[model samples]
Target: MGKAAIRIGTAMAALALAATGAPAVAGPQDAGGRAAPKTVAPLMGPRGVDALGHGRTLVTETGGTFSLVVERKHKPARVVPLGNLPTDFPPAISKGPHGTIYLLTGASGPPPEQRPSVLRGAAAPAPATTLFKWKRGWPAPKVVADISAYQKTDPDPWDQEGFPADSNPFGVLALDDGTVLVSDAAGNDLLRVWPKKGRIRTVARLMPRTVPVPAGLPDVPPPMGPLPPAGTPIVSEAVATSVTVGADGYWYVGELRGFPATPGTSQVWRIRPGSTNATCDPAHPRKGACKRYADGFTSITDLAAGPKGIYVLELSKKSWFAFEMGLPGAEEGGLFLVRDRGAMPRVRELAAGRLKNPGGVDVSDHVYVAGPLFGPGALLRLR
Candidate 1:
């Protein structure tokens, strides 16, 4: 599982702590004292957002409904429902050629036993990780790709749990050629899909990184029991969560490093155009088809690339675990911009200490962020 694991696990953790009457855990706190950015539209748990041009934007709620927000100069923005998606959690949306809309939903985590067993004449269910295509005047979107089906057949080579492949299709990028790129957070890979052919091919695989555990964690019971000693280095999944096309015509991906969720362990990777089966391992970073473009990010949930640079949105300013586990001050998230500058790249935080559990971001004429993620959220515009 990718984002779902975090969301669901957080809920369960909160419930357990409440039952046990435990005190709030201490964790990372927001550092910025600057004023928060202005809100563009009030939304309910908005998780995915994309700019639709002409002062319009598309946003998706955690409950599956889509919204279209229209902004006018010196006027309050208007919000309209764009209909609900079939999935409970729609993660990403992209505009395809000729007004086509591509949306992604679902993640790996349904128990194996939960798979409906086929009896006498019952048909099997559709794959959960799906890519949907829709256009105006259509009743609903049509399934263009079954991402989980491909994952089942071609499992993750670096799967930590062993057997039973995991596939959380989190990020999507639609190209002018009708081919779509998807980032699978659980599978730790990037896939290229041909909508017309209903075929999928692996573009790159992200290798797990070794992250040092942060200090000040408590030891608990079985299941999630005991924390490893602080500063202990452990291997973590490369939870690749986002994909965006850069101004240079190259593909950019951001990772949400898994378990222990060490802050500043995530990295943004760059993949060459037309690359296939590329490796994004830190061990052989430069030698592979995928190379590190930027590093030292924490729990990046979404990325947006523009002519100037790329916008990176973190789910939590602290590590995701700190936020998920409800550490005292881990409520605040962050937004950052990464820009190329000669031999060095500059990473700057924007509207610091303003965002809380921000999930998705995109740039058209302006930068748009969606957040608060678990509660009543909103779509905010950068100044």
Candidate 2:
């Protein structure tokens, strides 16, 4: 919900699979991928999407807005606005029971102070970021979660790339029990927020602690040559970008491999339901704990569960932070499909070359995707 859904921060992360069934998982090239051959309309920084039965869909316009697009038989589609964000930045969205809509925004991304260089001529920052909830036909939303108080920090938290530490909540899901799960990419952890309870707590650590890029570069996406001089963290400790509930009743998580643009390093991890302090250990996973659900992907940004399978969207194999750190990457951005649910879930690439920098995804009457996010992106209907 967070990273890919809004991509408010500089990068995105994602991956998901059913824990139910499938044979050997195969890369798109090996699985006879489906070619994407349709364009619906232009979407500005679409970071997330959800579909309500009967042809109605919600697409997030990254910078603080959700376009409620409705299509009918032989009718032109309609788009409506649905957010009151503090700043003009990308945010995340999710649909709950009984026509309920949930919107989440955090106080992160390029702060107003850095706009002179980072944003150049972008909109000014809002006073703060918060979560809003609404039921169908409700003219006003109820402010449920206050992430602003969590934004109060000393000396400011900056990442290895020297960017302001962000509370940019990317992925967000509204559980049936009235609890909300949010992935704070800036915080590199998952948060369990009880809106009604007025409580919040850490759920899991998307990536283990940052590690030094040992000799030979072990798992930093091949052919990157040797490591470069320092300016940022070589290993992406953790950017808990997205989260979803697998059919197995487990919480699946995704993360972005830090700088150096490690292609295969970014992973979608599996976490136990109601699990707290989940340790997503990619190197040496512990049984009954968080481990790699799917690897060999690049910058996975979002995921959506469909009748057929789980849809995965990757922003880019290349790294934005790496490019900033003088370590450019060869990006292969696009959409992918994950089937089965057991440990060895199957995977297939659908349209990567065409769907550049996809931010989020969802399934309904058809599959919907948004890309080139970060700003002025486009939305496509891939059936």
Q: Model 2, residue 55: displacement in angstroms?
A: 1.7
Give the residue spans of candidate 1 off by over 4 A. 1-35, 108-126
Total clashes for model 1: 0
Encode model 1's per-residue lDDT on 1-383: one tens digit a residue.
Answer: 23434343235234233433221111233345444566888776677788976789988765556768999789989997655555556788888899888887766323335433432221133457888877776656678998888888878787665643778888898998989999988788899999999899999998888889888666656776587888998888888889999999999999988878889888999899889999998887677779888888988889999888988889887867787666765766788899987446898998776676777999998888887665566788776
lDDT of 2 by residue, 1-383 (tens): 12222343543321111111211111233223664535455666667777665767787764456668777567666776664444444456788766677776655445555433333222233344566676655544566766545534311232444443456566788888778888776666667778776577767765443434422223334444445544434545556667777666667667755554455566777777787766666667655567667776666667677766666666665543332232333234657788876777798777545655566777777887765554555566765
Candidate 1 worst ten-residue window by lDDT: 19-28
Please report how far candidate 2 places residue 318 from its true position, in Å.
Answer: 2.7
Candidate 2 segments whose C-alpha is farther than 4 A from its true place: 1-37, 108-129, 137-140, 148-166, 209-233, 322-332, 341-343
lDDT of 1 at 179: 96
TM-score of 2: 0.75
Cα distance off (Å), candidate 1, residue 236: 0.4
lDDT of 1 at 228: 86
> What's the number of clashes in each of the models?
0, 20
